[model samples]
Target: MTAVEYEENESKLMRKAKENPFVPAGILGCFAIVAYRLMKMKNRGDTKMSVHLIHMRVAAQGFVVGAMTLGVVYSMYKEYVLQPAAAQKALEQKTALEK
Candidate 1:
């Protein structure tokens, strides 16, 4: 992508990450744990690297699922809880005005 478009996309991603910081935090936590485990290993080789690759894939998938789950939950809360409360407040204010 062009540099300008890339920067816009990056900013959007940063905005979302700031909104729901947990997903990024979880991803960082997962990678840190895996890195620690790998460092602790005395024997490292092709086989070990392959196994760690699988672990990394699992961590990536976990991040995706966690992010999706958090997004869904946040959407539901905003729709069901916040919207209704806002509507209720507006209705109350309208009623007060009429009275």
Candidate 2:
């Protein structure tokens, strides 16, 4: 493609990306895929498993599990705890305004 056409297309892609709600999740998934591939390559055989490799894998697994757990907890808090509180506050404000 010509330079101008490429630039126009790139700009359109950027604008679309800016509006995409899943961009963060997509980026995180890409990073996780790359990290998993790299870890596999690093641990490829011929060299017997060492203490360091085991520790590294354990740490990585812990990090992934911890992050997932945190995300679930935060989402639950927002949905069950925060939403009800917010709704109650809004209702109180509406009632006060009507008084």
Candidate 3:
């Protein structure tokens, strides 16, 4: 490909990386708030069972949020970065064969 096309492709990939960037940050913020609230409840002499339930809920929420964030990041990275690299390699090989 031409130099201009290569630069444009790189710019597109960077844009994809920056797109929807706030989602993971928001997820992490929610997790932090939930954890802090849970800690505060425990510190205020809440019942053991209630504390345990709160802990469980916080853990569940954290796990779900973590999984979702990871999934989104991985999918975006794979789609924008890894897939393009692989496709470029394949195209190069195909062009080499044609020549």
Candidate 4:
């Protein structure tokens, strides 16, 4: 590909990376709420061991969801916020040197 094409592709990637952090946080937030609710239900003693077992399954599902959500949020924060801030600092230093 030409230089211009490469640059354009790179810029698109950077923009996507910058905008990607919210999805995981939103997912984690949802799971946390769900797990909390399930735990509450478990505490109510409205079900037998089998019922509690089902609640445990529900809790496990929530845990998996929360973990996956965390992974996404972390990826987004690192790619968009942290990496950009670091890159900006490096770019500023480079510009200072050029001047």
User: Which pairs of residues have clashing backbones in candidate 2?
Assistant: none
- In order, what lDDT does every prediction score? 0.71, 0.62, 0.67, 0.66
lDDT tens readout by residue for model 3, 69-98: 776887699789998999999999999999
RMSD of 1: 6.2
TM-score of each: 0.59, 0.49, 0.48, 0.50
RMSD of each: 6.2, 10.1, 8.9, 9.6
Which residue pairs clash in candidate 3? Answer: none
> Worst ten-residue run, lDDT, model 1?
1-10
Index of the highest-TM-score prediction: 1
lDDT (10s digit) by residue, model 2, range 36-75: 7556766565755575466556655665566556666766
User: After aligning candidate 2 to the native by TM-score, how far in Å is the CA of 3 from where it should be?
Assistant: 38
lDDT for model 3: 0.67
Model 1: per-residue Cα lDDT at residue 48: 71
Candidates by TM-score, descending order: 1, 4, 2, 3
Between candidates 2 and 3, name the one with more favorable lDDT.
Answer: 3
**Which parts of model 2 are misplaced by more than 4 Å?**
1-51
Q: What are the per-residue Cα lDDT tens digits for candidate 4 across 24-93?
A: 4545666676667666774766567677657666765676666667768777887799989999999999
Clash number by candidate, in order: 0, 0, 0, 0
- Winner by lDDT between candidate 4 and candidate 2: 4
Candidate 4, clashing residue pairs?
Answer: none
